[model samples]
Target: LEDEAAYDRIASYSPYDNITAKPYPAILAMGGLSDPRVTYWEPAKWIARLRDVASAGPFLCRINMDAGHGGSSGRYKRLEEVALVQAFAIWAVERSAA
Candidate 1:
């Protein structure tokens, strides 16, 4: 019961519901298209909302078409995902500083 109530209450605080008309830092959202844990639409919809409510943030959504919740199967492939995230973080920082 508490969890259910929390869920209901969270809607008011949700990013989707509480989007402000202010500029925000850039976002890097990545997900797997075939992810069962978190469907691809989750990030896609969030990105759309961010674009609509806040035009200042540069939102980048990367969906791995052939991957699922765990992402790439191999160790090296997983590293690639990490690298991408690192690269994005660096890019965002540099862009913000400039």
Candidate 2:
């Protein structure tokens, strides 16, 4: 699938070694437990990979168990998405100051 290929390519180019390296920009990875196109495992695995490399960037992964796909659905659980975005904004602002 295109998603898997894209992720594979990114992982190939991603620096998964060397801590103390230049800090990457904030990474906000979110997944919906019911999403059929992309599994939650993808983000979780990527987070683990980044941690293994000891990345210096802000990496946050969140999952919405009651949601499906990526959207702002009023009928589904969306608090996690909103919280993640807010947190990312704050994090980016603080990091930019440093």
Which of the numbered candidates is closest to the native, going by highest lDDT? 1
In candidate 1, what are the lDDT values of residues 31-57, reduced to their tens digit? 898899989999888899999888788
- Model 2: weakest 10-residue lDDT segment is 14-23
- Superposed by TM-score, candidate 2 places the C-alpha of residue 56 at a distance from the truth, in angstroms, of 0.6
All candidates' TM-scores?
0.84, 0.64
lDDT of 1 at 87: 91
Per-residue alpha-carbon lDDT of model 2 for 1-98, expressed as tens digits? Answer: 66998888776766443233455677777788888987878777777767656456667787777667864477434664687688788988898898
In every candidate, how many clashes are there? 0, 0
The candidate scoring highest on TM-score is 1
Candidate 1 lDDT score at position 40: 96
TM-score of model 1 vs. true structure? 0.84
RMSD of each: 2.4, 5.3
